[model samples]
Target: MLDSLLPPLNEHNLPYPDTIHPIVVHFVIAMVLFAFVCDTVSYFTRNPKLAEVSWWNLVFATVSIFIAVIFGQIEAGLAEPYDAAVSTLNLHSILGWSLSGVLAAVTGWRYVLRLQNKPQLPTPYIVASVALVGLVIAQTYLGDLLVWVYGLHSVPVVEATRGGQL
Candidate 1:
């Protein structure tokens, strides 16, 4: 009997390579955390330039977070996570969407502050920024648990599932 060999593919299988979600999300995570740092530093140092930098970072991060979320949704479906990973994945997905909205709202507030030419960040905004940092940390932890601990979309996981061993 003659037959063609099956082509190799990575876990979360598709013929071509794909890593868009993690790459975009990580960039967004860095941008948001750095923005918070700049915001806090400017608040303490009274440096208008750093505040300006912080504003731009927030604006870009708000936009990028949406992109990250969209790609994450697509990849998450492709991942087809196992039973153990489902709850974590769902939580991460919810948080990812929620964070996008929260970032946009915070960015809008910051835009108002920028327009008003505020001398320093108000305490309320700073407090909210701290909360945002906490949320980001929680989201990061969930993502880490999925990839590092549960091995969602990893090669071995995919192979086992395909082999009906999972």
Candidate 2:
């Protein structure tokens, strides 16, 4: 069983370890979660004193999204061609990019609205944050689907059989 489980290491076609991909995904997810938490807390607390700090949270999350996009691109580049799971990976990449763009734009808009003292800024901020959370959920789900359903670039398994070396 142990022998069947461990594929011999080779130079030409080295398999990427499963652990790294999920770590990257989790990092991105954490960014989104932190953004949501900060936004929610700020909204409820409504302490004008913390306004600047709360805004910084969104800024930091936006930066993290950029980092995640880089990591996602690297992961995709490392993926093997002919893998049936590429479809989900492709979809994940597209959605992740779209989410990052929207988040960045919204964050910038919020900052502008803050400077302008726009009366309706709060409502738009709330709406944008909710949309970001929804996008995060969708992105996470797509990642899960790639792993569980598509099995993209997963380690190959070997089965033992009664016949000779099968």
Candidate 3:
């Protein structure tokens, strides 16, 4: 019924040229990692400019993650994931949502520190940033497993599922 309301799906089962989730997600990953880099570098160099850079990166990462997760949910729904891919997809989705909240919370804390013009990052913020990077790494691994290992949304996977081969 919903199919009638939308344009035809592509080979990847999306209504557009390609999956948008990954594209947006890469930006989030880059920003998140770069933010951590800036923070760490600032920590050692005592440069306020790097802190400002990290702050902007965190702010953008917080915003872009939501967009990534939204498109991720949409694409995951249309993916027609097979049995082998289901668990990973579900985990990825759960982590994706969890990361959104985590990113927001970290950003909020960072904003508070930024407002105070704190020169050095507190130990607690460093700890939380480390944890956030760990989560992002785990999420990236799961995402890779989904596409590279389980082949979710790949042409062959889509075709096989349609033909009952998956």
Best by lDDT: 3
Where does model 3 exceed 4 Å of error?
Answer: none
Per-residue lDDT of candidate 2, residues 1-166 (tens digit)? 8868857433212334343546655765776667566656667776544455556766777887787787667656654534456677888999989988987887788688669854333766778778888998999899888767654444431111112222
TM-scores of the models, in the order given: 0.91, 0.69, 0.98
**TM match of model 3 to true structure:** 0.98
Over 4 Å off, model 2: 1-21, 49-53, 81-84, 116-121, 157-166
Model 1: residue 45 alpha-carbon error in angstroms: 1.0
| Candidate 3 accuracy as lDDT | 0.94
Local accuracy of candidate 1 as per-residue lDDT tens digits, 1-166: 2225644557666434765877888888898899999999999999999999989989888888999898888778777688889999999999999999998999999999999998899999999999998988999999899889988777887788888877
The residue-level lDDT of candidate 3 at 44 comes to: 88
Which consecutive 10 residues in model 1 have the weakest lDDT in total?
Answer: 1-10
Q: Which ten-residue region of model 3 has the weakest summed lDDT?
A: 115-124
> Candidate 1: misplaced stretches above 4 Å?
1-10
Tell me the lDDT of model 1 at 7.
49
lDDT of each: 0.86, 0.66, 0.94
Query: Candidate 1 or 3, higher TM-score?
Result: 3
Q: Write the per-residue lDDT of candidate 3 for residues 110-164, one digit (tens) a residue.
A: 9999999877999889889999999999999999999899887888988998899
